[model samples]
Target chain A: MDRRDFLRLGSAAFTTATFFPQLSFAGTLPHGWLNGFKDNQGRYGVAYIDQKLQAEVLFHTPLRLHGIYKHPTRDLIVAPARRPDTELYVFDVTTKSIKVITADEGRHFYGHGQFNQDGTLYFTTENAYDEERGMVGVYDVTQGFKRIAEWSSGGIGPHQMRLYKNRLIIANGGILTHPDTGRATLNMDDMAPNLTYIDITTGQITQQFSLSEDLQHLSIRHIDVDDNGIVYMGLQDQVKNRRDLPLVWKTNGDTLDMMDEPVEGWEIFNGYIGSVSTNTHGLCVASPRGGCAHIWDQTGTTYIKQKDVCGVSKNADGSFILTSGEGIVRDLDGQNQRHALHFDNHCQAV
Target chain B: MKRFFLFSFLLLSPIAVQAAPSMQEMSLKVTEEFILPAYDDFAKQAHAQSELWGETCDAEKLKPAFQKTSDAWAKVQHINFGPITSLLRRDRLYHWPERRNSISKSINKSLADKDPASLDLDKFASTSVALQGLPALERLLYSDGLLDGDFACKLGHTIALNIEKIATGTDKDWQEALVNIKEGIAHPIYFESMDEVAIRFFTEMLAGFQMITDQKIALPLSSSLKKANGKRAEGWRSNRSTRYIQQNSLALMAMAKPFMSFMPDDVEKQVVAQFTVFARAANALPLSIKDGVKDEEGRAKIKKFLDETRTTRNLLVQTFTKHLGLTVGFNSLDGD
Candidate 1:
């Protein structure tokens, strides 16, 4: 390399070095390195995926909202909130107004609530920070917030619940992992796993299941059900003492299941797969932190990723539309230009 | 050998401070640029997205899984650092558009010419450097004291510096840095074509990164993950290690780019289409597995007890059919 070549190489080396800065002292999670947040942003509000970002601020406080349920026919948006207050905010999108929904003064939630297929009744999972007393409350989908049903998660903390007809398929993410602290700080070894299938109207545990081993620490939090009766769920593992696990699993509500181990290439990126949805082809899991859509065979078989993909939604068109980490909504058909959106409140499709 | 080189460039001038006799040159240049401030209608949209993804985030508590991969690689960087570092550089740098494009174009060009030196990873070619001396400019721009002249500016400073550094590619060694930088950007670029998952997943992408060397990936993927069965659930399986394959496989594809003229259209369409479809499905996978599962067994004697409840999603038949229909073109199965 001559002088000009020297300048170019020197510049290149410097760029490489600066761009790929050495990980200094892994020192207990460099909060400094993490910035440029998408999919969700700005004050306390509810985020949803649409043609672009549609942010409607419910509360002015710092409490983080967890759930946003759309009224089946009405343009009403139901948003469940946590911390500071356990209030659920209801908004009429067409009118662009708001209302608050809640269970009681004592309970707040770590997850969300959903409307019935008819949009008459709604269900929200409440953690209450007390595992023994944790419950899922039912409210009037429309009028005055009426409390109907409240059930238990056994031991697992229920953050998300998917209503499969009468069967409320809930992901009881066993332990309560804090958002204030990072993932490396939870204990999973002593966890108790149980998947309770309750007939929403009856509130009876018809069928129960377990992983049968060392994964009790795995929190069954998010779930998706297809046209078939198959319940596709997702998990979050508790980091015990000083260790963490990023392995994902799948089963057709059976004890015998396939653990979708991270690809040999992704062991280190043992991604926390979040939110699962299945198309005609296979299942798609979001590694929110990893920023990629890890698509695996329906049986938890093969993991083929579109990498760094996030906030996926079945588009108005038959294909799926997902938000990229770069705040672009890319069509599955591979269109020339993505419908670029951002969270002016928070960007990207959520 | 771990080498360190630090050369500071002189961007500021001493003559400006020394030169006396200052003139009252208060001439103003006003440019009314199109301005739709973020605080306008975008705030609500931004907030809605955060809560929506956050509420929906954690399909599988992936941070634990994602962190595990990064943790292991961090431990191994003490040795060959090739694959691991390549992955780290990819994640850390690719987040920037210019850096990402530059890295991709450089790699693409290098692959075309087969000459790695064409990459331009300049440390100083940046927007951040121009903004550094903006304290004086700040007092002039916003007519003073009206905007946050402290913390936000500091944050802007950090973002600029970070992006510039990423643009320069100066933080890591340059042995195979070209390929490393390209792969770093490409992996995410491929996977993240859709939604920006939650924060926890980003950590996993970083952690799940594995070191793929030329010799190792020469074999590419061993067996279809679906093919592995009961006994396949052994040693390496449980660990759920993530890999960074497809560099050479992709490079090989890039080389065949021009030669693709000879092949039929469906063949080419099926190839890219299948890979992308596979990529989409792969992207949604692990998080589904991680969040889709639960350990209610309490981790003790829960293993001996078994529960079998079957609920199959029939739509999957179509997905599998699509997989079968597409020509994946993996060399692992030759006899067929």
Candidate 2:
């Protein structure tokens, strides 16, 4: 379709009342979403889509946000600044005001957080730059998101996280980096990335599973849990030429299983996975670098090629909604829907 | 020389730093001068090599033709985005540092069976990507000094023909992309902003530099010179690893040239000086990069060249990108 047509469709797709009726969800789904977006003018914002499926800027951020977390019980959404940016904004939909939480000196948010099931406490991935260690900064949500405690994230660059039962699963990316140097990866050769499950109540590590020795350089950075409680993780290989390494893995809290991908389509993933989603149907991984989305089930896998596509979250009907930096939104079947803002990365379905 | 240096210093001083060209101008110029010409030249050379292959079966006669095509490819190899990538021509033309023995093995098996269909360009394009481009031709021409038969020559000819067809198609695709940019119409997803476009261009150039330094030099030379593995270097199958660096650096220099024209005089001169030194070293290297990595002095020279390129890259990031008002995006690799 032409640009004008796309613009019209985009506006119509988000036109408050009319949009929801067109959705297969029928406006009945209780949960909607929160995501990070950069507009055409390079401004960053945390956007919210309520139960009506209407999307708008809830609040603006100074820098790009990599991850957005919603409190399980509260009407609050916490957006941590991307790497090297210490600003974190906590916005309450009910109040329409945001409170800023700054990381302690030398500590920066890794752009991911997860709250306990009851929303009493919150866990954030942080980097202790000076010490070259990763820390999970714990906050008591009952007391104004206060910084109350901290725990080791079990690896160097802890990124995305998912709460499973009472345990928090952190994807410790393993590559060493310092905020002082500004995003330059320090230890690629000796990177030992792993999937660490920590007991949130006691702030103690429960278990960790790592990729095999040859595949250690695949930085396990993003994670999500399926309906069956299977943790699916996404990885980006630190080494560029190792195109054959697996970018998606499944774990049962004991062993990591890599889904078999056809070599031709796998190489197009460009040794990185942009985002991953798991719904009642199956698992989907987005590859903006490779310009494709990989969907897999127990029987087979399919790759849907779309340029700059990254943000992916499950729709109410179990289908996946994919967003791109191009200001376009599409479903897994190549159906182009519209959103007004350019999607930055992860699209979280709350 | 002293007077010229003084003039450059005044122009580059913070007080006199001039405004760079708009991102639109930068994009148009790069597309016209660097990208289009590089792809055009490769298409011509690949077609010519294919014709030469059809005329003779002698290894000596065909080797130079193959080298010309491969050399042409190295110039445009860094243009891995847009049309070339969409067509899968980037990997189809040269799946390097991945196993090339597979290409050799596939070609030999086809030749042994007198695979008549292998001579068809359409058929070959559908075949394994490894057997479709320069790496395949390199194997057919250089592996064990050219296999002994007319079928081998036919296979090489077909591969060259396939590359010519692919390159010509790629040139057309790029021309369309350039048109979209010039017209401010969005045909590709990355046309969100001129700043975004500039960032993409700079990122690719930076990635090219990274490949030359990290993959070509550092990985092979991991730990120390003594522990370096020559086989790990790019283009090792054809002993053109050094040549790969030289050509890749030159292309990167060409892409960065437009930015240089817009920079303050002193910064431009400094960057050019470093680039000149690096290019000279690159050109003066031994033909076979693998052999160069085997010795101490040679290894030192290569390392120094790598360092110079890194310095030039930094100047581009810190000075030119800032002057142009281009902002680099986070998560180029690990997206989510």
Q: What are the per-model DockQ values?
A: 0.01, 0.06
**Pick by lDDT: which candidate is best?**
2
Off by over 4 Å in 2: A1-221, A235-350, B1-20, B188-197, B280-287, B333-336
For model 1, how many clashes?
142
**lDDT per model, in order?**
0.36, 0.73
- Considering only N, C-alpha and C atoms within 3 Å, which residue pairs clash in candidate 2? none
Per-prediction backbone clash count: 142, 0
**Which candidate wins on TM-score?**
2
Name the docking class for model 1. Answer: incorrect
Native-to-model Cα distance after best TM-score fit, residue A33 in candidate 1, in Å: 31
Q: After superposing the true interface residues, what Cα RMSD does each candidate give?
A: 23.8, 16.1
What is the C-alpha lDDT profile of model 2 across B83-193, one tens digit per residue? 676556666787654442566677767877888876777778878776787877877777784557777777777887888888999888877788777875666433555
